[model samples]
Target: MANYERKIPILDCGHEYTRRVLHGKWKIRILLYIAEGINRPSELERHIPQATRRVLDAQLAELFKHGIIAKTIFDESVKHVEYYLTDLGNSLMPIVAMMGKWGNTHIDKLRKAINTSTALA
Candidate 1:
């Protein structure tokens, strides 16, 4: 069996905290959609058809609570709400992009490694 190696920690808890918020199946996608200006719930649903309405709403709410996203309510005759990434959330865009790049580049290698390890087992 190959031993697992520990990499250098970026910060004591920053990585863990970021992972916690980005842990949801749809969280990163939702953030990207919002960043691209899909603000309303309906728009978000349209963008991510695989995500159910209930799950989308719940995830957005959690993002809001984490200060990653903000909702602006337009109090007009017809009330309208739109979601946007907060500065904090915007800061994560680069990190997310890097993750995407890394995943795209290394997922195949990861799959091969896993398969090899499983075969050995």
Candidate 2:
């Protein structure tokens, strides 16, 4: 009879959820822009000129669905819509900032490692 060993289960990733929210071209930029007081869709588009309107709209929809952002519609004179981070989304700021700082600190080392690995290959 063959003996089987059980491997420990991997922990679920809360950080991964944050990373997932930031995934893709415009998502992070949009979130950061919103945090910096750029709230409207047109303003977000302006901030991220490289992103297509369709893509930006899609990502905004995803953010809205995930409860990361809230959309407010105005009924006054001209139709206006604004996006803002929910309390949940605001709570992720520190984690994202830390990730940015860590990335900045380790980027040089990561680049060197990549270069070495590619050279070996």
Point to the candidate with the largest TM-score. 1
* lDDT of residue 93 for candidate 2: 78
TM-score attained by model 1: 0.77
Which stretches in model 1 have alpha-carbon errors above 4 Å?
1-12, 110-121
lDDT (10s digit) by residue, model 2, range 39-108: 9889888888899889999999989988999989998899989999999889877877887799899999
Error of 2 at 1 (Å): 33
Angstrom error of the Cα, residue 85, model 1: value is 0.9
Clash count list over all predictions: 0, 0
lDDT of 1 at 49: 94
Question: For model 1, what is the error of residue 17's alpha carbon versus the real structure, in angstroms, after optimal superposition?
Answer: 0.7
Please give the distance, in angstroms, between residue 38's alpha carbon in candidate 2 and its true position after superposition: 0.2
Scanning candidate 1 in windows of ten residues, the lowest lDDT window is 6-15
Estimate, for each residue in 71-119, the C-alpha lDDT of model 1 and write its tens digit: 9999999898899999999999999999999988999998899999999
lDDT of 2 at 2: 83
Screening candidate 1 with a backbone cut-off below 3 angstroms (N, C-alpha, C), the clashing residue pairs are none
